[model samples]
Target: MANSLILSYLPRGSVVHKLTGTTKLIVFLLFSVATMVTYDTRVLVVFLVMSLAIFKISRVHYRDVKLILWMAFVFLLLNNLFVYLFKPEYGVEIYQSRTLLVQLIGPYTITAQQLFYHLNMTLKVVVVIPLALVFILCTDPSEFAASLASIGVSYRIGYAVALALRYIPDVQRDYHNINQAQQARGVDISGKDKLMDRLKGSANILLPLILGSLNRIEVISNAMELRGFGKNKRRTWYAKRPFATRDRVVLILGAVIAIGSLIFTFWDGSRYYNPFI
Candidate 1:
């Protein structure tokens, strides 16, 4: 519940953090789509390296990147396990058609094609994950809401987005507190308790958490209504700031990269690069 996991609330002084939330959102979607559409491992590696460089420039800590890398490793292991177990024939086909990259057990083998496929998938995560983490870490909740509202999102929807982001950290903190309270009360959460009993105990914590959150939300809503929140057709933002020239440049550059990647990928006539083909 170290609220740090969900949203880093880190100081937003970097160039990337200065960009409007709406612009970041667009860039994120475009980059994700481009990464998913390509299967060339070399291209994906290049993209991943570029993304890492951006993370460095943005001043995101190495520790955060390391944590993400651990998660990525877990994801990679799971992916390989599933593929090898369910699609052993795929490995054989790839190795036979391409080149044997590695030979495992008596008959099991890893092929250049299989290696590249997994490498590309891993690199996609490398490119997308850091950008996503940076976005959440650097952007302020209030600024994000203002940006969303400026871009034609209704105030209610924008507020909802902000509230959801805010609630992530709150929920984590609440869960940790509840866990500690239960432990203090001598609830055997980690002992040799029956699985059903442990699950029921965990479920019991949710009731208080949900009720507490509801009470807080009601208070906020009442305050907003008293201040004539929705009565005005036009709402003003105290934290709103106009997007700067650099933000414009970043948005344009992001668009260019997205479009260029799409055009090049399609022109190659292979959504998934298969060297065997």
Candidate 2:
């Protein structure tokens, strides 16, 4: 049960884990926006390094998120491949320079500009993934909900987010149990089985999973309603905490990074850092 959970908070008592949820959420938003707003390789590399440092501080092991990281890599590779396939000259258009490295059939020529653009895009993904994983793995759902509420988000919405995060592990556990039970009953869901047979077995699992999820949702809604949840415009959060000095410092640093990134990226009237200049 402990090893199977993904995206649920782990209490490691690390500095990142000890920080108030509000600080983490706000800082994450700032860094994410800053990263997406800039195409400067310098800034992106700095952000990537900082993100990795923070991930290390959060005490999350690579082995814990190995599957997710691999999935992200695969998806990133496919996305770049498709982008190049559809618009092989997009980088040249953006950078206003073209240096052909290799000529390929059907207008699919490789160029330095294309490779550089792809490198920046890949860095964005790599930078953001570590920060996001740290946020998800270090934050408790209850505290995250309170953090959202502190930022003036609706309590109902905050609670919904909390529930979703809290339920991810439960859903995985349920699916595992159901898959095991079905296999015991002769449902061939193993990879050694034919693809069609596996699909059928998976379909059989989906029905029960959906029904079970709906039932759990209904029960939760009824419980909340009976307890007079959402009866007022505001509600007190059980996990709310006051911001400490560290929280304030982090938030200030986040603001500096965000504003500095904007200035660095656009002061020259363009987001791209043109080495061809």
Give TM per candidate. Answer: 0.77, 0.97
The CA lDDT of each predicted structure is 0.74, 0.92
List all candidate RMSDs to the true structure: 4.0, 1.1
Give the candidate number with the greatest TM-score. Answer: 2
Candidate 1 weakest ten by summed lDDT: 1-10
Candidate 2 residue pairs in backbone clash: none
Window of ten residues with lowest summed lDDT in model 2 = 1-10
Assess the local accuracy of residue 129 in candidate 1 as a C-alpha lDDT between 0 and 100: 81
Angstrom error at residue 173, model 1: 1.9
Candidate 2 C-alpha lDDT tens digits along 1-277: 6656788788989999988999999999999998998999999999999999999998999877887898999999999999999989889999999999999998999999999999999998999999999998899999999999999999999999999999998899889989999989999888899999999999999999999999999999999999999999999988988989999999998999889988999989999987876
Whole-model lDDT, model 1:
0.74
Candidate 2 backbone overlaps, count: 0
